[model samples]
Target: MIDALSPLLILLAVALPLALALAAALPAFRARALDLLPFAPLPSLAAALLATEGARVGVPELLFGVRLELRGEGRLFLGFASFLWCLAGLYARSEMRGTQRPTLFAVSWCLALAGNLGVFLAGDVVTFYTAFACLTFAAYPAIVSSGTEAAYRAGRVYMVFSVAGETALLAALMLAASGAVSLSIGGVSASIASLPQRDVVHLLLLVGFGIKAGLVPLHLWLPLAHPAAPPAASAVLSGAMVKAGLFGLMRFMPGDGALGDAWPLLLLALGLAGCFYGIAMGLTQTKPKTILAYSTVSQMSLMVALLSAGLGEGAAGAAFGALSLYALHHGLAKGALFMGAGLAPLARPGARIGFLALLALPALSVAGLPLTGGALAKLAGKMPFSGAAETLVTLSAAGTTLVMLRFLAAAGSQAGSGSERLPAARLAPMIAATLAAVALPWWLFPALSGQDLGYVLRPDNLWSAAWPVALAAAGFLVWRRAGFPAPAVPPGDILVPLTAALERLRKPWAAIHYPPFPKRRSAQLRARGMKVLLASERGLLSWSLAGPLVLAVVLFAALYRP
Candidate 1:
C-alpha cells in the first residue's frame, strides 16, 4: 500500500499545480484563481513529507519516457521548496490583491510552482529539461507583473540570460544523451564523465547552471529582477527558483569527481571570487531587496565552492548532504528576509521595534550566529575544508553579517511609510516563514549531517560561529559611526557601463543610414514569410497561449502514460 501510494503522490505533486494553472487560464475561474493559489503547492508538500526515498513513477508515453523519483537529497530539496512555495503563494494572494493583470499573475505563479516542484522529482533528462523550460519561461511574467519600465527591463534581461542558459544546457544534454545507456538522469550523469567530449560538456553545464545560480558577471539579472518583482515573487525568485540551477548542477555533474582537476579548480576560483564580489557590491546598494540579491550571489557561490571542494577530493557523495542543508537554511532564511522587507513599510510606529527584532532573527541566522540553523549549515559545509579555505569560509560569515546589517537598517527605515496598520494576511506568511527558517534546520540537521545537536553545540563549534559575527558587528558599528563612507555603486554594476557603451554605438550606427534596396518578387515573398513566422512566434510566446500549452502537455503525460 505504501509503495503504491508513493508514486501516486509523486504524480500528483506535478499534476496538481498544472491543473490549477489550466483552471486559472480559463475566463470563468480567472478571478477566483488567486484564491486557490495557496492550495496549488499542497500536493507537492504532501509528496515531500510522505513519499518514500528511491520510489519512482515512470510515464513511458511522455517525451523520451519521463520518470519521477524521490531520493535523499531530492526529498529534502522538494520539502523545503514546497514549503517556500506554499507560503509564497499565500503571500502573493494577499500582496497582489487589486494589482493589474491578476489572472496572468495567478497563472504564472501556478505554472512556475509546478515546474519548480517537477525539477526536484524528475528522474530523466527529458523530464528535467521540460520542467526547467516550463519554469524559465513561466517566471518572466511575474518579473514584469508590475508593468513598470524597470520591471519590463528586468524581465528582458532575465529572458536573455535564461535563454542563453537553457540553450547551453540543451546542447550539453543532447551530447550526454547520445552516449548514455539510458535516459535516466543518473545514467546520463555517470556516462558524461566518460564521454570523449566530457570537458566541453562540463563547461557547458557549469556555464548554463551558473547563470541561474547567480555566479559572478553572469548574475546581473538577479539584482534587477528581485527589486522589480512583487515581494512574494521576489521571495521565491531568490529563495526557491535559484535553487533549480544548483539542483541541475548536482543532478547532472558526476558524483565520482570525474570532472578532472581543472574544472574543480576553476569552479573553486570562480566561487571564491563571487563570494567576495557579491559582498563588495552589496555594500554599495541602498535597496534592501538588491542587497539581499547580492547576498544570494555570495551565499550560492560559497555553496559552489563547497561542491568544488568535494569534487576535487572525490567525495561529492559525502558533500551532497551538507550542500542540501546549506541550501535549505539559506532558502528559508532568505525568503523570510524578502517577505519581511515587503511587510516593513506597513508596520505601525509602535510595532517597529518588534518588526526589526523579527527581521534580525533570520538575518543573524544567515550570518551564522551560534546555535542557529545557519551555524549548523556553516559547520557542515566546513567539514570538507581546511587551512586557508576554511578560514576564508569563516571570514565570509563576517561579510554576510555586514550585509545583513545593512539590510536590517534599510528595512527599518521604511517602516510606517505605507498603510497605518499591517494586514494579517501579509504578516502571517512572513512570520511563519521566519519561524520555519529558524526551526526546520534543527529538526533536519541530525538526519542530513549524522551529527547530534550536542556536536553543533560544542564549545569549539560555538566559538567558530560566534567570532565572525562578532567581528562583523563591531565593524558595522564602526562603519556606522563613520557614516557609511562607501561610494554608491549602481545596482547591476557591470550592466550599467555595458548598456552605456551599447547606447553610444547604437547612435553612430543609426546615424549612418543605407539606401533602400530595389524590391523584387523573391525578396517580397521572403519578407512576407518572415513576418508570418514572427507573428506565429509572438502568439505562441504569450502567456494566454503558452501557459495552457505547457499544462496540456504535462497533463497528457500524467493521464495517458501506460
Candidate 2:
C-alpha cells in the first residue's frame, strides 16, 4: 500500500499548494483563500512522513522532463521545512485576520509554500530552478503586505538582491546542464567535476545561494525584511526559506576536491566573518525580530563554516547529516521565537511573566542550552571541526546567547502592549513549535549521529553545552548593569551607506544632461519605437505587475525549453 501511494504523495506535495494558489486567483475564491492557508502544506507534511527515500515521480513533457525524488538529506529538509510552513501558516491565519490584503497574503503564502517545499523534492535542474524562482517572486508580496513605507523599502532592496541572485543561479544552472546527459540533479552533480567551467559554476552557485543563506555582505536584505514583514512571514523567511540556499549549495557543489582548496577556504573565511559580524550588529538593535534576523545570519554562517570544514577534510558525508540536523534544529527554534515575538504584545498584564517564561524556552534553545535540541545540534556541528576552529565555533554560542538574551528583553518589554487579548489560535502554533524545537532533536539524534541518548546526556557533553550559555548569561547581566555601552548601528547595516553613496553618484549624473537626438525622418521613427518600448517597460515595472510578470517569464522560459 505504501509503495503504491508514494508516487501520488510526491506529486501532491508540490501540486496541492500550487492548485490552491491558482484557485486563489479567482474572485470567488479570493476571500476564502485565507482559510485554506493551514491546509496548503498538509500534502507536503504527509509526504515527508510517509514517502520512502529515493521514491520519485517524473513528467517527461514538463520543462525538459521534470522529476521529484526523495533522498536522505532532501527528506530531512522536506520534513522540517514542511512542518515549519504548516505551523507558520496557522500563525498567519490568526495574525493576519482582517488585514488589508488577505487575498494577496494568502496567495503569496501558498505559492511560497509550494516553491519552498518543491526545492527539496526537485529531482532535475529545471524543476529546482523553477521552484526557486517561484519562491523568490512569490515571497515579495508578503514582505510588503503591511503597506508601510518601511515595508515597501525593504521589499525594494529585497527584489534588487533577489533578482541578481536569481540571474547568477540561472546562468550557473544552464552551464551545469550543458555538460550533462540527463537533466536530473544527480546527473549534473556527477558531471560537475569534469566540466570545463566548473570553477566558474562553483563561484556563481556560492554567490547566488549565499544571498539566500544570509551570508555576510550579501545578507543586507534579511535584517530589513524581517522587521518589516509580518511575524509569521519573518518566521519562515529566517527558519525555512533561508535553508533553500544551503540546500542548493549542498546539492549542486561537488565535494570531491574537484575545485581545489581555495573555494572551501574562501567559504570558511566568509562564514567566520559573518559569525562575528552578525553578533556585532545584532547587539545594537532593539527590535526583537531584527535581532532574530541577525541571529539567523550568525547561525547560518556557522553551518556554512561546518560545510566548508567537511569539504576541506573530505568528510562531506558526515557533515551532510550534521548540517541537516542543525538546519532542522534552527528552523523549529527560530520559527517558535518569531511567532512568540508576535504573541508577546498580546499577552495580558497578569500573564506577562508566564509569557516571557514560555518565550525563553525557544530563545534558550537557540543559544544551545543543555538538554535541548540545540545542544545535540551544536555537538553534531562540532564533530567536523577540531583545534582552534572548533573552539571558535564553541565560543560563538556565547554570542548567540547574548543576542537571544537581548531578544527576550526586547520581547518582554513589548508584552501586553496590544489592545486585543491573546487568542489560542495565535498562541497554540508557537507553543507547538516550541515543543518541537525542544523534543524532536532528542528523538532524531541517534539516527542522525549514530549515538545513544545517554551520549548527549553524559556529564562531559552537558558541560560543553552549558558553559558558553552560562558565561554569556553572566556577561549579559554585567552588560545590562553597565548600561549596554554599544553604538546604534541601524538594521541593514551596510545598505544605509551604500544607498547614500549611490544617491551622491546619481546627483552628479542627473546634472550632466546630453544633447537631444537629431530629428531626421529615420530618427523620428526610431524615437516613436523607443516611446512605445518605454511605456511598456513602465507598465511592467509597476508594483502590481512586477512579481507576476517575472513569474510568467520564468514559467515561459522553463516550458519553452526542450
Candidate 3:
C-alpha cells in the first residue's frame, strides 16, 4: 500500500546521498561519482512528491534509537527543500564542470544534502540536533569552496557563530529534555513548561534559533557567508538551510507553549526592525549576491513577524498554514533568483530577453506581485495580522518591492556586458526552478491551506496584494527621476568595526602566549621572586611562625564581626 512505501521512500531520500558520501571515500568511486553530483537529490525529489502523508521510521542501530517522521510542516519543508536542492545540484553541475577538485565539492554537497533532508524528517530532539549539527559543519566546506581570502574569512565568521548557536541549542535542548517524560519532539515541547527554569530555556532557544534565522545583531554572518559561497551553495544556504531554525521554533514552541506574551511581541518588534533595516542596507550593495542576501534577511523577518503574531493571537491553525505556505514559496523563489544570478551574465544576445524574463519572474514574485507565489504567501501569512500590524505588513511589501527593483537594476547591468551565452546545461535548471517558483504555489495553496482558489483570486484579495507593489513602482519611478545616489556601506557593515576591535586585542592576546619582557630584566625579576618565595616558605615552615599565623587568623576570624 502507499502508506507502507512512504517511510521507505523517505529513508531512501536520505540514504542515497549518505551512501554516495561513503563511496566518495574510494579513489575510483570518487572520480565517477563527481559526474553524478547533479542527480544526488533526485530520489529526495521523488520522495517529496510521491509520499502522500506523514510517516515514521526508526533506525536504532544507526543513531541511538533514532526516529524520523514526515508530517505537516515537515512534509512541506521536505518537498520544497528537496526541490531547491535538485535545482541547485543541476546549476552546480554546469557551473563546476572542468573545475579542479570536483570530488571535494561533490562530497561536501552530498553531506550537506543528507543533513538538510535529515533536519526536516527528524522526529525527536536528539535526531533533530544531530541533523542540525551535521548541516552546520558539513556546509563549511561549501562556503569555503572558492578558496579565496574572502571565502576563508567568511568561513571563520560562519564557524564562530555556528559554534555559538550550537552551544545555546545544546543547553536549551538539555533543559527541555530534563522535564520531558518522552524523548520525541512533541513530548518535549508539551513538557517544557513544567521545568523550574523554563524561561531561561525559552530565551536560550530563541537566541540559538534566532542566530540561524538571521535576526539582527546575530545576522552579520549570513551576508558574509552567502556571498562567499558558490551560487549553488548560496541557494541552499538561503533557501533551505536557514529554514531549519524556523522549523526549530515551530517544533519546540508549538501552540505558543509557555513563552507567554512577552516573547512573541519581542519577536514582532525585531522582525519589523529587520524588515526596514535590511532594505536600507541592501540598497548600498554593488554585488548582486550580497543584495540578495539582505533581501533574504528582510523576508525572514516578515516570516518571524507572522509567526509572532500568530502566537500572540493563539490561532495555531491559521498561523502554521500561513507559515508553511510562505516558507515554501520563499525557498523556491529565492533559490531560483540565486541560480539566475549565476546565469544572468551568461545570457547570449539572442536569448537575452528570455533570460531577463526568467530572472524577472522570481524577482518580482519575491516582491509579492499579483498572481505570483509571493502574493499567495503574503496573503496566507498575513491572515492573522489586522489593524496597524496589517498595514505595516502591506507597507513592508512595498519596501521589499523597492529592494527587488534595485536588485533587477544591478542584475540587468551585469547582463548587459557579458559575451558568454547560457548553455542548455545551465539554462534548463534555471527555467525549471523559475517555473516552479511561479506556478507551484498556485497548486500548493489550496492543498496546504485548504482555501479555495477563488478566495485568493477575489477582487478584494487581489487589490490587497496589488496596492503595495503598485505604490512601490510609482515611488521607484519618482526616485529614479530625482536621481538619488546609492549610499556606500561595506558588505558587512557592522563587521568592519567588530573586526577592528578584535585587531586591537590581537597583540594583548598574543602577549599572553609570547611575552615581550627584555631578557636581562626577566632574569633579574625571576631570581628576586624566587628568593622572596623561598624566604617566605622557610619562615612559614617554622612552627614558631606557623603557630602565630594560625592563632592570628583564628583571632581575626573570631573578631571579624562588624
Candidate 4:
C-alpha cells in the first residue's frame, strides 16, 4: 500500500510550495511564508533528481477527483523547470528584500512554480490541466507586480489571452474526454485514437496549446507579459512557462496514429510562420527584454515544427527529445539574456564589457552560430524539418540574426557612468545563468546524441552558421550608415490593429452572447436587460456563492442528473 503512493510524492512536490504560499494569507506567518517562498520549489528539484526511470506515482482522490501520475517524461521536465525556479526564487528574494507586500510576489511565484512542476509530473489529463491553469493564473501577479502603466497594460493583454486560452483548453479537454470518468491523458488519447472526429479534437487541442506555445496571433501575450515582469519573473516566464505548452502538446497530442492528412502540414506552416514573424517583430523592438520575448516566440515556433514532424512521421519520441533540448537550451539562454538586460542599466563599463562578452555567447548561440547550445538544439531538431520546413528554418535563422543584431544594438543603449555597477543580486544571476546555459548544452548534447561534435564544428557547418549572421550584420551596417531609424510600429506589430478590432468586438461581448440582446432603447428595455444580466451573473457572481440555498440546489441537481 505504501509502495503504491507514487502520486503522493508528486502531490507533495507541488503542495509544499502552494501551502506555503497560501500560508502567507495568514497574518501571523506572512513574513516566514515570504521567506519560505524562495525555497518552496526545493521538493520538485529533489523529485526530479531522485525519481527512478519508469517509477510511477498516482493518486485519484487529490484535486477535483483527477488521477495524477508521475513518470519519466514528467521527471525530465520537472527537473529542469524546478531547478530554474529554485534559482529564480533566489533572484526574487534579493530583488524583493525591502519591497512592500513581498508575500504578494511570493504567493504568485510559488503558485507559478508549483503549477509548472506539477503539470510536467502530472499523470492524468485533468491533473495536468489543473496544474496548467494554476500556472497561467499565477503569472498575473508577477506581470502586475510593478504597477507601472506599461506593466498594467501588458498584464491586461496577458490576462485576456491567458483566460481565453485556458477556456479553450478546458473545452477541448472535455471534448477529448468524451464523458470518460478516467482522465489519464494517455487513456483519453487511446480512446480518441479510433474516433471518427479526431480532426476536430486535434484542431481544438492545437489551438489551445498553440496559444500557450506563443504561436503567431496568439503570441501577443508573450511580448507584453515577459517584459512587464521583474527580471526574476521574466527569466522563469521566458525560460520555463512557455515550455508548458510544448509539453502539453507532446503529452496530449496523438503521435502514434494517423490523423487527417492535412493537420501536420498546417502545424508546420504555422510554426514556420511563427519563427519569421517573431524575428521580424523582434528586429523592430527597442526594449531588450521585449526583443528577447520575441526571440522566445520565434524559438517556440521552431519547436512546434519538430512537433509537427514527429506527429507526421510517427517519430514521437524523437520529437520529445528534440522539444526537451530546445526548451532547455532556450530557457537558460533567454533567461540569462533577460536577466543580463535587466542588470545592464547599473553595470559599470568594464563590468558591462565583461558581461557583454559573456552575453554574446548565448546571443550568437541563439542565432545558431556553430558550437553553441542553440546550435546543438538546432542540430537535434534538424531531423524533423523537411522540404518547406527546412527552408523556413534556414530563413528564420537569418531573420533571427537580424533580430539579435537589433537587440545587441539596443542593449547597449542602457549606459552607466564609470563608477556605477548593478547590484550583485542582479549581476550574479545573469552571469551564473549565462555560464550554465553555455556549458550545459556542450555537456548534455554529447550525452544525448553520440553524433560527432567535431563534425558540427567543421568548416562547412561553421560557415553555414556564419553566412546568415554575416548577411544580417551587413544589413545592420548598411542601416547604420543610412541612420538606423526605429520602425513605425510598436514592439508588437499587427497587435495595434488587433487591439482596435478587439475594442470594436468588446461591445458585443459586453452585450451577452451578441446578436440576441434587445437594444437598450428605453427604461423598460434597459431594466429587462439588467435583470437578465443579473441572472446570468448570478451563475458566476461570487467566489463565495456557497449559500445554503445554492448548496441545496447543487445537491438536488446532482441527484437529479441523468
For candidate 1, write residues 27-59 as lDDT tens digits: 999889889788998877888888777989998
lDDT by residue for model 2 over 103-207, one digit each (tens)? 889989989988998999999999999999999889999999999999999999999999889987987887788799988898987787788888888888998
TM-score for candidate 3, residues paired by index: 0.89
lDDT winner, 2 or 3: 2
lDDT of each: 0.88, 0.89, 0.83, 0.76
TM-score of each: 0.92, 0.92, 0.89, 0.86
lDDT of 1: 0.88
Worst 10 residues of 1 by lDDT: 547-556
Name the 10 consecutive residues with the lowest summed lDDT in model 3.
547-556
Score residue 489 of candidate 2 by CA lDDT.
Answer: 93
Candidate 2: segments with Cα more than 4 A from true spot: 514-523, 526-562
Candidate 4 local lDDT, 475-506, one digit each (tens)? 88898889968675575577788878988989
User: Rank by lDDT, descending?
Assistant: 2, 1, 3, 4
Query: What are the RMSDs of all candidates, in order?
Result: 6.6, 5.6, 8.9, 6.1
Clashes of each: 0, 0, 0, 5
Clashing pairs in 1: none
